[model samples]
Target: MMALQHRYPLALAIAASLLSGPVLAQSAIEHHVWQDKRKFEPYSRTAESITGAIRLSGNNQFATPGSKMTITFGNGKKAQLTSVGASWRQWDDVDGKKVTAEVFKVAKDPGTLLNGNTLCGKAAKYLVFHESLSFGASLLGVAVFEGSKEPKDINSPGLCGTFNYSVD
Candidate 1:
């Protein structure tokens, strides 16, 4: 009985090591690769556009995940989108001679303040936005997502840098 007790631990440890060896080896061989554009869907451009960015950590480096923004301009007259925030803010400038203006919440993502997948629950945890804009009958805008926007009811995101995507 004494000999069996000593051998049992050693035998179990050996079995465990053998069972886990392939899994551990496979994990060591797996790594992430970077690409300028996703082959599944090369960034696209149209009269409408979408854009934004968020950090995606892989290996030792962090990269911006992918996001697409579409725009509608020229004949486009109105803009509207849903917001994750409880309210939306809009600013109106009455020229350099303005004295005062209206201040209120629109209750949604008015004028495209982080809408669509940025707030949707069914999308990736990170958002990386890319925009392609043109002048004639084309769209132009920037999109950015901050992990801070994530629900506080859950544990806060631990990323150390601000996530952003801008268009110029």
Candidate 2:
């Protein structure tokens, strides 16, 4: 009778674990994929307006006098002017080497434009830079994307470095 009493307690414990196994497993899986929708509300603005200036400068130490840069926006917007006139010299650190860098600047026509019909009734401001040499060599440039409601300062090297713009 004593042995039977001990065996009865063990049997009850096993049954309890078996009954709760599926419930615990289902709760764990549900918790992993759950997301709170209240944190992801969308913006209410539909169009964004941008105004800025673009400038491109190349190093004269490399003797790349014909180095060219261009800026394009949305689909059809592009720099208005293609004049390379400004030149300066400064000490610059390039790839861990310090040297006197002769720089020449290419100015782009400054203007303003609008990008519209964005989804979520909202849009972001961004700038992209492109550089190419007369020898058929191309260097990839940088892009910046910012999501904001106010005017932003858009600047980049080997491209535009000064500008004022707004989004609405």
Candidate 3:
């Protein structure tokens, strides 16, 4: 009887573990893979809106002389930005080195043309930036993308990552 009593607890524990195994393995929430909806164009400096090489200056300001940055909205409207002086900042990382973003000013205001667009919306002027030479998982480095102050988030619905550029 003493042996059987000890065996009873052991059997109970085994049974409890077996019964709870399936329950513990099951998950209540469902997960799905996320997909990006927007399309990206390749960078071509030849005969492109921006024809000149973007060179960084010692003063932290850069210029794209004889070149213009073309921003095409989702609605098919476009805004051209001259190679006016721009600012730089150390943001993001590539190959363990800090990535610098050179933000250029828009040449002119597109007015209502930029209002209520699918990407970044409603702005008199847009901020364009060139990323340092760096590559990531599946995407290569050295490109230009849209920047916005109001939205702030890099992955926000704004016009970020819409453009692809290569610096000279």
**Local distance difference test, each candidate:** 0.27, 0.30, 0.38
Q: What's the CA error at residue 93 for candidate 3, in Å?
A: 11
The model with the greater lDDT, 1 or 2, is 2
Better TM-score candidate (1, 3): 3
- For lDDT, the strongest prediction is 3
Candidate 3 backbone collisions, by pair: 120-159, 144-165
Instruction: Report the Cα lDDT for residue 153, model 1.
Output: 18
What CA RMSD would candidate 3 show? 17.2
- TM-score of each model, in listed order: 0.20, 0.21, 0.33
Tens digits of lDDT, candidate 2, 38-90: 11111112112232222223222232444443444443455422212221221
In the range 7-115, model 1's lDDT, one tens digit per residue, is: 6988877888999999888876322221122211212331123323312122221122122222222222222212222111211111122111111111222133232
Off by over 4 Å in 1: 1-18, 26-48, 51-143, 146-168
Ranking by TM-score: 3, 2, 1
Q: Sort the predicted structures by lDDT, highest score first.
A: 3, 2, 1
TM-score, prediction 1: 0.20
Best of the two (2, 3) by TM-score: 3
lDDT of 1 at 155: 22
Off by over 4 Å in 3: 1-62, 86-88, 92-97, 109-115, 118-124, 132-135, 138-168
